[model samples]
Target: MVAVYGGRGPQTSNIQIRSIPSVVRRGENVELLCEVENEPDAAISWQRVDGDLPYGAESYGSILRIPSIQGGGIYMCSATTRQGIFDERFGLVIQEEFKRIVKLFIVNNISHSTSEVGKSK
Candidate 1:
């Protein structure tokens, strides 16, 4: 007796972000990578979940590049194949350099003032 078996079909699964910075500086270029485990021909797409996509953002293959990361929000990547579709989300937190310096100054001044008040008492 002879038996015939069919090969497995394309499937989109184990979608993940290969690399992404936890914190991105304003006006800096950033690249986010999305990977699928089994499907090499999967089509990848990107979308912003929390806000509008940054200006000049584009996707090449499985990589999403932002010419300049202006604002911070949730970004999602979708991988589609013949068998199924998978998605993964990434959080992009943006920090402004000037804002950080100003915030530090304000916090230091507040602390200094509080210490002075306690000493006076």
Candidate 2:
């Protein structure tokens, strides 16, 4: 008689995007990482969920690098294997310096106007 042991088949799970920066400045380069627990032979692909895939997007294994972060939105990475497919999402936020400066100017003007009203009374 021959003895054989059966084990679970190939599956993809635990797909995650790692080390996303909390803040990213406009026009800066950024890298987004994707990781998945899957069969050894699984393949990974990356996509932009919000807009057309960036022109400079490049992928090496599980890492995707964007030459410049022009806009803020969601990106997706997917892992595919013979057994199944799994995917995860990451969000990039771009902060524009011009917006901050304009906000500061408005705030200063409001403060000055309030102070003048108080002095008039």
Best model per lDDT: 1
Question: What's the lDDT for all of these models?
Answer: 0.78, 0.73
RMSD values, in order shown: 12.7, 11.7
Q: List the residue pairs that clash in candidate 1.
A: none
User: Model 1: runs farther than 4 Å from truth?
Assistant: 1-12, 99-121
Worst ten-residue run, lDDT, model 2? Answer: 1-10
* Poorest 10 consecutive residues by lDDT, candidate 1: 1-10
lDDT of 1 by residue, 1-121 (tens): 1122336643225778764566989889999998877678989999999877888998998998898778888889898865566788998888878644444444444444334454653
Tens-place lDDT digits, model 2, residues 1-121: 1122335643325777874584688778888888765455668898889887777889997888888777878889888755567777888888877644444444444434334454653
TM-score of each: 0.68, 0.66
Residue 104 lDDT in model 2? Answer: 44
